[model samples]
Target: MWIFRNKSFKSAYISIIISTLIFASLYALSNFNKIGLSFYDSTSSSLPTKPKIQEKSEWLTNFVDPLIGIKNGEVFPGPCLPFGVVKVGIDTNDAGYTVDEAVTGISRM
Candidate 1:
């Protein structure tokens, strides 16, 4: 009890009380896992914007198949003459909950 009369003891006691109060306040708050108590979130206002293009549908004329290295495919039956367009299957990654490079269907090439 006599040691409490010292100014250092008084300072240490005050520090302990302040620390306990801080701990109690933090424990009472739900967001104590995060640092610096904030009443409101700054990032709650805005959301991310979507991309411009949604689907990939393009027409290619005189298209040559790169795999076979020959323009032997047909538009409907016989070999499509030069400077002719054809529909080719390709992948689209615009707006959908699907795997990347997932081919939807064939379109005009």
Candidate 2:
């Protein structure tokens, strides 16, 4: 088809097709309950569970420093860190991962 054959618009065309496929799959899964999430969760109305109330770890809660979770000096805090990957560049071949979104999709010069 001419839409898919346009060389200059290959990237945009491919991205749209991929996005459409992903959206269709998600919609089907949500409707059919093929995935782990049961579709009935939405159709059947249920009372919400009482949220847990926590009092401890107030210091950790108030801390906004993103780097607070990362330790550069002294003994290693822990093997598995609770750090956020602020930026990630995508590779087209990500084990068939259909989602190809940019962490910082748009940037200004």
Candidate 3:
């Protein structure tokens, strides 16, 4: 009651209570499965299913591979993981862009 006499302290106390309630509600919703509560309706005709892995691989190999090489030897033409910081590939023009020969050593960019 003494703390609530100050406007700032009263507001801070109310905000803390509200924030705690919100966090608890969110935690309960996320752990609904463990609490024997199903968010998904069993009466629904179709159950959710994961997409085929092969289709994703094929799409990336076919579509992404060709588009990656469009930078005209400046970009590396080697296998690179998604969001990779370092890229390892052959340098086609180590001497300069004028020379059309592959460099012997691998370059990381």
Alpha carbon lDDT of each predicted model: 0.56, 0.51, 0.69
Residue 44, candidate 2: Cα error in Å is 23
Worst 10 residues of 3 by lDDT: 91-100
Residue 91 lDDT, candidate 2, scale 0-100? 31
Q: Candidate 2 on 1-109: residue-level lDDT in tens?
A: 5655667589888889999999999888777755566634665558467898776775565666433432332332223324523423233343221333333332221
What lDDT does model 2 reach? 0.51
- The clash number for model 3 is 0
List, residue by residue over 23-108, the lDDT tens digit for candidate 3. Answer: 99999889989978897888886888778568665675565454354346565456777776777766554443223565667667
Q: Which runs in model 2 stand beyond 4 Å of their true positions? A: 3-6, 34-109
Order of candidate numbers by lDDT, starting with the best = 3, 1, 2
Ranking by TM-score: 3, 1, 2
Best candidate per lDDT, number? 3
- TM-score (C-alpha) between model 2 and the true structure: 0.26
Give the runs in model 1 whose Cα sits over 4 Å from its true position: 1-4, 31-109
Model 2: which residue pairs collide?
none
RMSD of each predicted structure: 16.7, 23.8, 8.4
